[model samples]
Target: MKKIKIYLDYKCFPIWIYNDKGELIGNDLPKELADDKQADEVFVKIQNIYDNLFINDLIEFKYIGFSSEIDREGYLKMIDDAVKLLKIKLGDLYVIEEKIEV
Candidate 1:
């Protein structure tokens, strides 16, 4: 049996989009904020879009890692686990597998 491997790539941003005075608002930092000379003084907790999704438990397989790539065996395993855990059809997902000479 091939072992399943899954890699998670995270795009994270600050959790708080507002300024200290509670004026500016948004999920991302505005240009005004970026232009601020004191921008370095601002600090906020960061979060990933994946954090908003409740599928963490489903994607958190035993072979999951924080790398950008996974081997063929690992990818297959992840697909199988995802289908079984999410109770979804394999056809619903899009996957491309290729062979590398290296």
Candidate 2:
């Protein structure tokens, strides 16, 4: 299992996640606002379990509106595009990308 390394700009509001191979897996908003409190805790758990996610294995992350304002729908779409890019570039090794402003 390969864990992905990802950096989240507190300013961006979508959850960003990566695998060990440095690939974007999944990004989306939380189920609700109240869930924000538990975002870090849940993320830690996710990391603990998926510390090393294999290639092709989806690793989803969220960019909550915590540190800054971000486009919810756009971020999600970015995640989708990132995943596709990873599949194409890494194929089944690893995928990772930097957060960009759209």
Candidate 3:
């Protein structure tokens, strides 16, 4: 039997964004948010965006089995298509992968 496995590193974006632009450093924020309370609010909003990412499923699929090799290949093609679509929409923000095993 052959199987396909896919994984999503859902936290990839928040981690990358935080490390790169989380300018909450050294008590220095852009003038617009120099106020500590406002900077904290902006930080909270960014966190909300990160949370929304996990709430939405780009494509929905559970473990589905195929009866024959031909069917398996066809389904795999569909998965490949889905992955491409996701890349277009998500812009490589998530660590995504697919694996086929026999």
Tens-place lDDT digits, model 3, residues 1-98: 11112422333221112123433223222233345563344434433433443444567633334456785576556545655544454453444345
Per-residue CA lDDT of model 2 for 1-102, tens digit only, reads 332334444333345545455565545422332344444444444333232222332675443242223544544454556445444544544433444332
TM-score of 2: 0.30
Q: In order, what lDDT does every prediction score?
A: 0.32, 0.41, 0.39
TM-score winner, 1 or 3: 3
| Most accurate candidate by TM-score | 3
Q: Is candidate 2 or candidate 3 better by TM-score?
A: 3
Q: Return model 3's CA RMSD, one decimal.
A: 15.4
Q: Give all TM-scores, in the order shown.
A: 0.20, 0.30, 0.35
**Candidate 2: which stretches are off by over 4 Å?**
5-70, 95-102
Residue 27's lDDT in candidate 1: 39
Candidate 3 accuracy as lDDT = 0.39
For model 1, the stretches where C-alpha displacement exceeds 4 angstroms are 1-12, 19-24, 33-55, 59-102
Sort all candidates by lDDT, best to worst. 2, 3, 1
TM-score of 1: 0.20
